[model samples]
Target: MTWNCGNLSSKLATEEEYKIYVDGSYLDGKIGYGLVVLKDDKVIDELSGYVSDPDAQDSRQVGGELVATKEAIRWCQSRGIKRVAIYYDLDNIKKWATGEYKTRKPLTQNFKEFIDSTNIKISWHKVKAHTGVKWNERADELAKAGANSQGATKKNGLVDDLEEKAKKFSDYLQRRGYSVNYKGIYNSQAAKLSLDDGFQDIGHLNIYNTKKLHLVPKYHELRDKSKQSELEELWQEFLG
Candidate 1:
């Protein structure tokens, strides 16, 4: 355990004794990844970051953890923590971290940079979360705080393609007189899956209040098939 030695403690941290535990919490109902490094119940380092809607199109936490995990790796490396035992509440993170999911979030060059430069060795462990494991709980709190931080939507104009896509989905919903709220996103997604998995093409979906409305994509297709009018000559009509 690091005593209260102020700034000197960090510089004097010995490699053999520099053990760290890493974990993350993504946005609620989404993956907001967060990690905390502890040396005998004392916090040496922590990091939290998220992947969220650019236009606040929806709160998609699962995707955000991919971004967070990348950041977590960078965080660990910057601090010179070479020997790490990374823990996650979700087994999927372990799977993704250890290369079980091949088609996981696409990594940027910066991600590759971290991977190539590090002598850090990461070992993953799955912990029983919300079970009062002191450091784990602290990690949860840290992750939630990061996930909920105010950057869910920031228009830098650099995100040309994604912004366009998000806007297209936004415009489609608006034309249908449907407004986006948390429940609406899920309901829309569920209704989309009910139509075809491509229903998520509309945007993030949440079915929290699905009973109140009938968001049937089949109905949309039948009623507004003309929306497909912009298609090529082959689809001038359904059977064409």
Candidate 2:
């Protein structure tokens, strides 16, 4: 099923239209999706869950988005909403949805069918990611929470709910009057935590830094082995 809006003009939706923000979170072997339904800037409901045992071929970041989008359509249809807008942060979604991109991926093809079948006047809106948009940020946090709940890692022989930890750490920062960025990490010099505190609060930072380490094209491995500080510095530099 495709969006067959033959004569329906595309434009920014208003407050009267139901709005749903969807985001996906992925880890080593798990995927989670978060959805927030809203109207008039007030939340109507939220939904989140992990994709159980996704096939290796379908267990990708885009797979999570496809699942979430498919469910969002069903949710809107169930509500009998005549007009709705579904917001996502991925540019790739636009390409796929608009028929500008195609692949043999089962999930993508299946999602097209799902969209074509849903009976609702819908529009797709792509938003800038991790920019602190309220509902979008909440959806992201929910996705992370779902991921942690489903596939929480073992640390010191105990289950570590990194998403929950991230949420609480973000709350602490807020209570301390520290401005938390959309990624749930504070970047302000005045509010910045020490390296130890940073790692403790933002567990994903270590993952991100570690990923950067592996992305090096080799030859500089030794020099960059001790450059975690430099990596973070570069991240902050990018943020600026």
Candidate 3:
């Protein structure tokens, strides 16, 4: 669960702002990063990368976080975006941004230099991990997918497709006049299961169940179920 109830419908206060959430995943000896960019609460883009160097002195977790953070800023820069809001679960990274923490390691130095060189004005947000935040959870999924990646030729299509579908579904919800929380809907369902209870292991059960949960009548009343019949068909087609 990477989302919470309080922030489900949260939106950026200004039009010039872009929200970016970054997360890192370390599995076995591999490391990866997840980067998400959003505008007006709609996902505009995302990226993930795997770091193959296990011999690096810095831990994979730190390396992934640093790389994701640096690249996120670079992404904003490339887009000519000057006002950006960055969210991460790592406290050390937040502290480093605020001048409350410092390190002399080459990796850290390089990251710091990159930040100083960037002209973007960034607002930093520190969020609790695994609390059901939509973009944050998406980043976590991407990072895990990256960690599991074998190489350029072995990219994971399933994860990527699921992510894209989820974003499109979220957009659909917005268009349908529903302020749905993509990750929170799944978490709300998962919370109902008793501890130690095991259900059929659907691939990416969260995404699957979230779709099912929304298709019913209880979640929210549709503005026009008849008008949305076509959307329902498209949705089912994608899921199938």
Candidate 4:
């Protein structure tokens, strides 16, 4: 089989086929992925790892998902297995592999090409996330653990300076009565920030390598129109 997208069937796979449950996690801006391989409903192997590639970092959890799936496929290939089923929480995993979604991003394009290069029979199944599905939940737990396992490496001067500025910006927003959350190091040079007004999210701020900042607003048009000027003022003040 090339690929099948939908819910898993009640029937179990044969002895020759393997079932792999995969999940990706993004924690504090670190991306990680986990996978559990099963044969006849018994665990055969488990894999988890942190993704450090800059391209994967930009894709976040989706990057982890694709990595997990690809790793699982490689594992099967190494063992001479030709048929496998992949269970995943994200729809994009299936969409990208099946050509249902365009692979505009570099990470996605690479993922699609990797899948095309493989000769194994792969089937994709969507599993509802955080619903306590046994293998699926295990994959999620492993993914989180992998994300937490990212090593503490020393940063360069530019990164250090950018992190300091991001912290100051967060503190400034908090002093102004807005809730500020930091997403740690987004990459080697940037960090992600989230802004909220107690009950609703205002937008995300990206602190870049050049010390420039950009806001991605999530506020509703009509309801947040009055607050636009205030946000602009905050941005100016932060830059100033």
Candidate 5:
């Protein structure tokens, strides 16, 4: 989703109104949502819980975001609150609710319907993630905590194995005096590896289908064919 800072209105709401920051996390097949409620810029409540649904597994982190917003709306309705502001990181959270984007998936359709049926007045604000935003960061931390609470489940063992291999490969490159950063997304069936030279990115690696791996040189003009061959040989050795 595109990231943009939405307008933050100058006229702030009164103490009677609520401001809620919501986030979701997905890890190793576990999904969780976190919500932080505030009034008059003071924390009033914090909520976090795991989601155990097959549909959520398909939507991944976005599913958790939907659940968090849904929970926030319920909290406001229960307290007889009329006005509230929702701070979110994902653009679809606001787009689906405001009809700026169409909801094709069943989970998203359900979420949009829930928002449409809610009586409470809701305003949405987009916040850039991991940018030192206090409540937003807190919400992310809580979401991760909730996901960790689920522990390990009977998910895709192959994906987990691939992730472990990716980590080992990253360490192998690091030991050879190369700067490496690896990230594995469980649901995507791929791992991304970036190789840097302490100044600029030198190359990238992608493991696809959990078996096939590809290395792409970042600057083909600057690097010779021998360096590319070396990286290929190293990958082959690691795989063997």
Candidate 6:
């Protein structure tokens, strides 16, 4: 199976010796489901399947977990990772893999096949939900972001201006080898990242009453720190 765009990006962030976490939620006999991915407490990508299994009647039925795990496995395999740990709140999935349970649906079974198809060493851990863990918090953000993945609609007038400003800030971040995340709350609420000497807070630049301009990204390199100010200047000139 192929990955949704958000899943891929979320997986990429965890590349090369990073902790990876994946979460999925489904409702209504698996009619609507979404997945969230995280790396090192940062959101990489998320995806909600556009599945229309209308015949399903169980609204509480969760269908997206297996596919999400499949993508997670893909992420692990592609990186040639030999060992990793995953967290799942649901015990059935862990049990199924451990041969403790069985499901009639091929979803988790297919995931089992995918797991067997690979030689990587993986471990699953169960963590308490809503307990304020790092992985859980990050996963929550990713899942929520995925749920809103229809793409943010372009706003008009003032909203447009704020978005543009956010983009400009994000561009400035990218020029420094940092991935900009503009969808989170703007009051530094989502920033779990640390900036090197070359970075500046520049304060929150709000494009609207409800928005503050706290845009930060990971850019850490001793050699590159000096250029941070220069890029900031260019960003000002371009956005001015």
Candidate with maximal lDDT: 4
List model 2 lDDT by residue over 1-240, tens digit each: 234222342445653367889988887767778889988878989988675534422555566676677567656644556667788897776567667678467666655544444445667777888998888888888777766666343331111233333323333333333223323223211121212232232222331112223211122222234445544454444335
lDDT tens readout by residue for model 6, 1-240: 122122344454344344455555443223323444555555665544322222222323244444445446545543555655566555575666655677456555544545554445556656676688776555545544443432342233334344435544543454444433334234423322222222443232223323453333333432445555765565566556
lDDT of 4 by residue, 91-132 (tens): 888889989999998888867766775657887778899998
Per-residue accuracy of model 5 over 1-240 as CA lDDT, tens digit each: 111224543243342367999999998888989999998889989998776656678888998898899778767654657778889999889889878899998788767766665556777788899999999999999898878866452265555556546655665665555655554443557666666655666666666544454322222433333456667677778787
Task: State each candidate's clash count.
Answer: 18, 4, 8, 0, 0, 7
TM-score of each: 0.44, 0.56, 0.56, 0.60, 0.58, 0.45
Residues 85-128 of candidate 1 have per-residue lDDT tens digits of 55556656555444455432333232333333334555555568
In candidate 1, residue 83 scores what lDDT?
58
By TM-score, the better pick of 1 and 4 is 4
Error of 3 at 156 (Å): 16
The parts of candidate 6 lying over 4 Å away from their true place are: 1-16, 27-61, 148-240
- lDDT string for model 3 (122-177, tens) is 76777889999888899999888877774662454444444435544543433333
State the C-alpha lDDT per candidate: 0.43, 0.54, 0.59, 0.74, 0.71, 0.45
Stretches of candidate 2 exceeding 4 Å from the true structure = 1-10, 56-58, 151-240
Query: Which residue segments of model 5 deviate by more than 4 Å?
Result: 1-16, 151-240
Q: List CA RMSD, all candidates.
A: 16.9, 19.2, 16.7, 16.5, 17.8, 14.3
lDDT of 6 at 69: 55
Model 3's lDDT to the true fold?
Answer: 0.59
